[model samples]
Target: MPDFKRGRSFLRGAPAACLILFLAACSGGQPSAPETAAGPTAASTTAAGAPAVPSASGAAPPSSAVPGASSSTRPALSKEAQMETDRLLIRAAKANDPVQVRKLIAAGGDVNAKDDIQDSAFLYAGAEGFNEVLKLTIAAGADVKATNRYGGTALIPASEHGHVETVKILIAAGVPVNHVNNLGWTAMQEAILLNDGGPRQRETVRLLLEAGANPDIRDPQGRTALQNAERLGFTEIAALIRG
Candidate 1:
């Protein structure tokens, strides 16, 4: 994990449109002030299997259970009802209301249900830096590594937002640190490109590195983590990588 510094001109003009898209996809939609509301976002998806909470180690039953269906006679939630649930989950997530969320999960809300844009409940929680919501979703069986339409995983979004605790929770729970998206960006890459390389972001790089992210790992553009660091003028990060 290294940091590179680029001038304001480079920072403002660098053609990282695709990278921003990738980061946006991974980081849960767009930039917003941290929300204290408890609800899901427009990107949640229906969990596919039995909705069981994840274990302390992050393992959970498969996502195959149909929401609102009994084992013998389970029927899927109506589209309208499902939509409302999605909204509730997103709001609850933003609000960090784990209690209501638990109630929804117990009542057969689709933990994996995607909002209109295909974002999962877990992704929304991760993107918004809702630690409690994220843990509740994961414990309730949301996919920690699930990618949205742009192939962004929960781990990716959490990392880009510099949510160190969230990222750590995801990693310790088995999210792949080095997992790449369609744009060839990894969690480590996201941390470097953020330009806001504070201690938490630095810690993110350290985590990814210790998790075995290759400091020399190159993106499709032949850019390595060190290169990105230097490009961003993150000298300390560069030094860390060299060390």
Candidate 2:
């Protein structure tokens, strides 16, 4: 973004209106940040689901017998109530407080509700490695397919962090095994990318595979999971993919 004075000079002493337009241009880099405390900045969303807390592998990506009414079917929350619920839900999720999450939901909070950035209780739970809370969200109607602002499903982040049980629960609840985010990476890709392809992530990949996730999906640059694993020296993971 060029400075106003510099832009003005470039425009040969343009009128004051031109300077105002220059200011707008100077601010045109990324999308504007959401005007809510719960919503992280655009910069945050770019890095793997804008995790509230970093998990063992990385800040991650949930599911249950108690099926959640899909987001489309669930009633939308008023902005005020949703904002308040977002505060409690996110707070409890980051803290891994299943009790609090349950209490809030029982008190009329929407399970599939989203914050300003489209993050939900389930999403926060998975990204932070909060298994029990994830279960609570699932039982309370968290959508297995609810996506964040980046179009990455909750499984993508959970896989990225290598949360074995968390990933399993999501898969069991019927989240699409091969769903691609806007970035064109699957949960398998995220799992291998964020780990040393250790046993835990191997298990995550295994669960995804057993759930029928495609192993041959390519990234935006045409890199397959095996190629990524091989390049990263994750022999075990590469072997699993190759087989």
Question: Which candidate number would show the highest lDDT if scored against the true structure?
Answer: 2
Off by over 4 Å in 2: 1-83
TM-scores for all candidates?
A: 0.64, 0.65
State in Å the error of residue 69, model 2: 19
lDDT of every predicted structure (CA atoms): 0.73, 0.78
Model 1 RMSD, rounded to 1 decimal: 34.2
In model 1, which range of ten residues has the least summed lDDT? 1-10
lDDT of 2 by residue, 1-243 (tens): 576565545678678676556656778754444466756675456545743553466734222222443354334556686668767877777777888887887666766777777778888887667888888888877888888887988889889988888888888877887989998899999998877788899888878888888888998889988899888999888888777
1-243 per-residue lDDT for model 1 (tens digits): 112253344446567764565456555686444433654432332345434455467665455643554462213567787678767876666577888887776655666778778776688877667777778788777776688776878778778888888888888778877788788888888888864878888888888777777777688899998999988888877777787
**How many clashes (backbone N, Cα, C below 3 Å) per candidate?**
53, 4
- Model 1 scores a C-alpha lDDT of 0.73
